[model samples]
Target: MAYQQQQHYQTQQPMPTMGMQVGGGNRNAAGKPLDSNGKREWSHGLCGCFEECGTCCYACWCPCIVHGKNKQRINHLAAKGSPDPDGGACCSGSCWGHCLLTSFLGAGWILQCINRGETRGRYGIEGGGCGDCCTSLCCHSCDLVQVSREIELEEKSFGQRY
Candidate 1:
């Protein structure tokens, strides 16, 4: 009876083969496969802003422009091949909003935090809301550049897929 029971239990369990997508296979919005934990690190670190001097300068001098461009890219990716609702404009409402908020309320970090969180979630980036808020509040310019680089990398990878 014990031998028969062991055979039955072993037959009921099937092992996953190599390259098999177990648990329906987790993927990010860009359709990239994720690890077992369903998370990945950022392509660039916050302090690596100098890696892209032009982008770093742009973000430092005119953050609104970089913010707008980043938003447009994210929207384009989210929309896949569809038309972007923001019309892919660099000076869209989001950019203006960031500018106005920073110019007046000095609370532009709020919008930055929101955008960062959204980007992290879409890319399955390993981060939490608290970290996002702190990064946006403390290293505003670096955060923008980091996100810009990440979106650019994602676009490159996504483009190759099709």
Candidate 2:
């Protein structure tokens, strides 16, 4: 019963990681560890980079998920108006939810590991659930803005070369 309540509190409470701090208090930028909706994925931030790629949607800062050639991982779905699948990037004409990291990391090593791309997708919209139904699993994730920026630079370089 206590465990159940702990979980309930966890769910309802604002969960934050080590480095992610928000307002003047001990909260995150949004006053909560998780996003407003408590759901985060590839594009994590004020918005998610999925179904579209403006800000957080389709954007990623987590490490690269290695996929074999011609590998079909996600059962890609087309939302409204997206684009083509260049690197099998969660294509719904846009970015599908990517395995992303939320803002809170437990240990210092965890933060280092994230910087080094050792662990990926431990937070945010986890596709893996409690083995039953998908109960909107929301957790503190990393701000992959740095990672997203890096991708943009690479793309720009690639374009210049091509």
All candidates: TM-score: 0.72, 0.23
lDDT of 1 by residue, 19-138 (tens): 443332222323444567867777678999999899899888888888888888777767663324453477889899999999999888888898999988866789899999999999
Across 65-142, the per-residue lDDT of candidate 2 in tens digits comes to 321100121111112111114544433221221222223332222222333231123223323323111111221122
TM-score of 2: 0.23
Report lDDT (Cα) of residue 142, candidate 2.
25
Error of 2 at 125 (Å): 27
- Cα deviation in Å at residue 103, candidate 1? 0.3
Q: In order, what is each prediction's RMSD in angstroms?
A: 7.7, 18.8
